[model samples]
Structure formats: C-alpha cells, structure tokens
Target: MRWFFYFAYICTMETKTSKIFGLRSVIEAINSGETISKVFLQKDLTGAISNELNGLIAQHNISRSYVPIEKLNKLSKNNNHQGVVAEISPIEFADLDAIISTSVEKDKAPLFLLLDGVSDVRNFGAIIRTAECAGVDAIVISKHGSAPVNADAIKTSAGAAFKIPICKVDHIKDALFQFQAAEIQTVAATEKTDNLIYTIDLKIPTAIIMGSEERGVNPSVLKMVNAKAKLPLLGEIESLNVSVACGAFLYEATRQRL
Candidate 1:
C-alpha cells in the first residue's frame, strides 16, 4: 500500500505537466503563443543560445531563472533539457483593475484574497479552491514569494484555480495599495487582532490578506491594512492552518455579503 501511494504521488507529480525542455523546444513553445509561466536557464550558460534565449525573454517579458544544471535536470526529470526549461501555466492570470471594475459594474462588492508568503502549494491551492467557492472576486499573490501554481496546485484546487482570477504582483504591499486605490478596504488576518472576523463588516469592497503559517503576517503589511482580524479559537491550539483560516475568513465575508 505504501508503494502504491508512492507510485501515485510520482505519477501525479509527473503526469499532465506542461514542460518544454531544450532551448529550441522552449523557444518554439514561446513562439507558438503558449503561456509559459517561467523559463529556467542553466547558470554560466553562454554563446548564441544563451543570447537568443535572453532576447526572447526580454521580447516576451517572460519570467526566467538562472539555475544550476542539477536543478534543470531535476525539472526535466533527467531528460535532455539542453540547459533550458519552461513551465506553462494552465490558466491565464487575471487583471486586478478589471476584476474590481467588473464587480462594481455588477453591483457586487469586490472581495479579494491577498496571500503573504504563502509558499506551500497545497495550502495555496486549497485557499484558491475555497475562495472560488465563496465567490471571491479575485486572488492576489506576490510573484516572488508565493507558491508556483503548478499541476499539484491546480489539482488540489479541483480546477477552481482556472475558474478564478489570480493576480500576481511583484509585492503584496503594492498590491494592497492598488486595492485601496480602487476603494477596496484591505483587511489582514493576524493573531494580533482582538476583533473577530465576523464582527468586521465584510459587506463592502474588501481584500483579505492571509499570511503563511510560519509567519502570521509581515509587520509592514499588517500596519498598512485597514483592519486586522482573528478567528475565535476554542481549542488549546493557538492557530489554524493558513488554508483553513482563510476559508473561515472568506466564508464569513460571504455570509455578510449575502
């Protein structure tokens, strides 16, 4: 049974992954209008191929990484990567402005989720799934610190990630400001808050910021949020899993809105 579980995990990790290896193949995939999430290049790569890849990256504004050969090999599963690999995103990212505007146009308040340092793929996926079910307007995540929205994440979300808009920004702080600029109040979920989530009025345009389990929330981000909230705990456990807490917060907002 353990072996079967191991095999299933391996198959899940490898199967249905849209990865293009080798420089030529990656370039071709990009040229074909595929939505490549990011390209990984071997560190110390040089010559015409490297230059060509760089040119294409700049031309298409593609995200890239300079990694060791071992890393590339792992990504390629020991296949012939030829010093390059590109991950294709299963779904398109959403535009934050458009999401807010559409929500307002439909006479619905915008409710978004902003994740701070939530790098666990499974947790991220679960939060996305719950948010979609809760009818969140969109989800915002930092491009650098957030988990990769890969096959596992998509599967864990049960295809909800594709149905919802995922707005990736360079930083969560800036994204929070963008929400405020659009008249959406930013709320942070942290233990520092004595205010219960249900007590806070979530019927208005709102963006809820959830931090990683390791770190409750970035101090700077906590300071910037319009309100801070915490879930009530009856048990001895001091905290809830980030995904679970997020679902609770989102549903509270949903209940308020409805």
Candidate 2:
C-alpha cells in the first residue's frame, strides 16, 4: 500500500482550546489585547453585552461566528458561556511588514514560509519546529479556513511556536504581493509544473509557499508566484505529508545556504 504524506496551520496562535467563556469575559479578553483566534456567539443573542462584544470584534478585526447554542455548549463544556466563548491565542502575531523590513537589514538572504491553507495542528506544529530548526525567519498563514493552533500543535512544535514570528493575513495574496514588493521571490511548492526545486536558487531572499493538505497551492495563487517547483517522487506514492514536505523544502534551502 502506498501512503501519501500531506501534513500542515492557521493565522493565529491559539495554542489550544484555551478559551474564555461568558459574554462579558470575552469582551474583557479582547480589550486586554489577548490574541483571540475566534469568538463564537449565540445566534440572535442580543443584549448590552452583545453590543459591546460586537463593537470589540469590529474594533479588533476579529473573526466571529454566530453559532448555535449547542456549539457553544460543546466548546464551553456546558460552562456558563453566557452565549459567548473566545479562543485565546497563547502567542501574539507579528507584523509581516516589520518582519520583512527587519529581514532586509539582515545579512542572511531571509527565508520565509507561507502556508496557503494547511489545516492540521500536528502538521502545523511539526512545520513550525522544522522551520525554526532550519533557520526560517517567519511563517505566514491566512485568517480563514485554516486549522486552529491548538495544544497539540504547540506540543508538536516543542514550543517553537513561541520562538517563531507568525503573521496572520486576510489573504495569502496579500503576503505574496508584499514579498514581491520587497523584491523577494516567491516559490510555490506544487506538482503542477515540470520544474524541480533542486534547480531553484534558494540562496536569494525567498518565500516558499506550501498549499493546503487537501489540494496543493490554489490555482489563483499559483498564477501569482515567481515560480513553482516540487520534490521528486520515484515510487507510486504520490505525495509527502505537508509537514514532511515542508521540512524537506526548508532543509533544502538550508543545505544550499550552507
């Protein structure tokens, strides 16, 4: 039997289901600058506290979903959720611009990892650990549809999640354009091309883009990159785990640099 490896992340640092229950409590967490991955609100829930929570969500540009009370119940373990629950991120996200600017000032050609839509916490954690070990400068992820950075991911990363600067963006294209603007090249990891990563020059300032576990890079995103390459597969097995592929890509860059 052939086993394909497809492994992977989300936009924020939700080190797990570390959550805050109660409407007023969630509001407080937001005001306190706690990194919140998301807030689940009871559908049609209306009150002074609800208004405050909505305002906070808007002010902070947080992602909120009006879920059924049952969903909240499951998330809160029947705790006094008060119609609201907020998933708290253990680590704060860094600004992509700041990381780019700082990297430009550095001596090493700055290597970055951009996840298109990787969705597994275990994969995400492994990727983070490998990225840090391979000297990756930062990792970027989209704000929606990606997996949450739960405790499993944190444990898998061996706390590398705390060590790395992760950036959350509204769209993958935003980060892609930013890198291009800075004259940094983007190389998408995909099997859609005849190009092999071995031929690509990893010594330059580069951002390597890995796609979702289900699909490779999005067709739209692939059109926007400087290049697309893939690792070789000699056997019948078609793919590598997302984390394993990420590690391979990262280490390849490391190998070339060394």
Candidate 3:
C-alpha cells in the first residue's frame, strides 16, 4: 500500500511538471508583440509547440536559446514550465509625426538624431541616453536596419527610452524630405566632409544624422543631407564609435543653444 502511494505521487509530480514546461504561454506573448527580453527552449525538443514557437520568434525578431530542460526547470523555480520561458517588459514607443509636431509647436529648435543602419542595441540605447541628456527632441531610426526596442535597449538607456521620443520610419529618405520641408537643417556626420561639426550652427532647427560603424550613412541619405560635417580627429583612430560620436555632436549642439 505504501509503495503504491509513492508511485502515484511520482506520476502526479511528473505530469504537473510536463504540463508547465514550454511553448503555449511564450507563443501568446510573442503574438502580442510584447517586449520579450529572451526566450529559452529545451534542447532537442522537436514537437508542434516548439515549431510554432520558433516560427513566432523568427517572424518577430525575438532572441531565443535552446537550453537543457534542467535550465528551464531552474528558471521556472520548478514550476511546470514545460521547457520554455520568456522574459518580457512593458516598454512603449512614441509616434513619429506627433513628436515632430510637438517639438515644432513648442518653438524649440527641434534637435533630432537620425540613426542610419545602427544595428547594435547597446549603441542605440546609449545614444538615446545621451540624446535625452542633451535635450534632443527625437531619435529617428530606419525600420529595416535598426535594432528592435527590446528590454536590453530600455535598460541600457537608463529609462531614457521611455522618456525620449523615438521615430521609426519606413524609408529614411522620405523622413529626410519631411524634415527639409519643415525647414529643419539635416546634417550628416561623415568623415567625407571637410567642414567640422562645431562650424555648423546647431542652434537652428537641426537634425543630426549618425550612421553605422560598418557602412557609415547610406548613399541616398548622404546625398539628401543639407550639410555634411565631421568631428575633427585629433586622435589616431580614423573615427569615433557611433555612440561616442552622437554624444559629442549632441553636446556641441547643446553648447550652441546655451
């Protein structure tokens, strides 16, 4: 009788454990476009649930990991996690046109940061922190080449991601055209320019374009810029990292405004 009870208890525990392990809850979160920090899946678990989870992660650009079942178990604190867990956040995005209109209506100079092909989430977050500190009105990024505004990005921004306006656009060129029409001077930070950043008057309505570390600004964006300026390189390095360059440019603008 005692032996039978022990066997039944073991079966019940195992059943409860399996019920809680894996994809159902995680898939629901992804489908909602929730800010998923990370997703973990049991290694070698190939099933309907895993397939659906993988498809959703890929479609939404959510980061994921295939880990041992024990890892998932540990994460869930022995809850029936079924073999998957996802960390998420409550981050929000700002509307692009609304930000632009609000900045202009306030009679502010509308100091803006335009990021071209900057894929690194850390860099994106750091730039946002600096831009907020320097009183930039908004930070614009292209939809295709930019990093997703995930939990890591929000944390890296020191909460500035929530405080500052971020504009995600379909085509950077179209956004540039709108800025130009609004009488906002668009300046590209490029090594190709002979003019230095300090020489340009940022006190006026300005949009500063900072490009990617690998490719610099897209050629079309470079051509559309009202002016192209470079930070004078006194050091041996050819150029500053994108985030550092963004800070320098922003502070220079701040100084001019002051």
lDDT of each: 0.87, 0.88, 0.80
Candidate 3 clash total? 10
lDDT of 2 by residue, 140-182 (tens): 9987766666566776787789899999998999999999999
Better of 1 and 2 by lDDT: 2
Q: Give the winner by lDDT.
A: 2
Model 1: which ten-residue window has the lowest total lDDT? 5-14
Q: Which ranges in model 3 have alpha carbons more than 4 Å from their true place? A: 1-90
- Tens-digit lDDT track of model 1 for 119-214: 898999899899999998889887666777788788788778888999877789989888888888999999997999988999988999999879
Q: Itemize residue pairs with steric clashes in candidate 3.
A: 20-80, 20-81, 20-82, 21-80, 21-81, 21-82, 21-83, 22-81, 22-82, 22-83
Worst 10 residues of 2 by lDDT: 1-10
- The CA lDDT at 4 in model 2 is 22
lDDT of 3 by residue, 1-258 (tens): 976865665455334422123478888877776656567788887888788888988887655678898888887888888778876643555677787788888866888889998889889889988999999988887756676675556656766787887876766787798789888999999998799998999999999999998989888889999999989888788888899998999999999999
Worst 10 residues of 3 by lDDT: 13-22
How well does candidate 3 match the true structure in TM-score terms?
A: 0.70
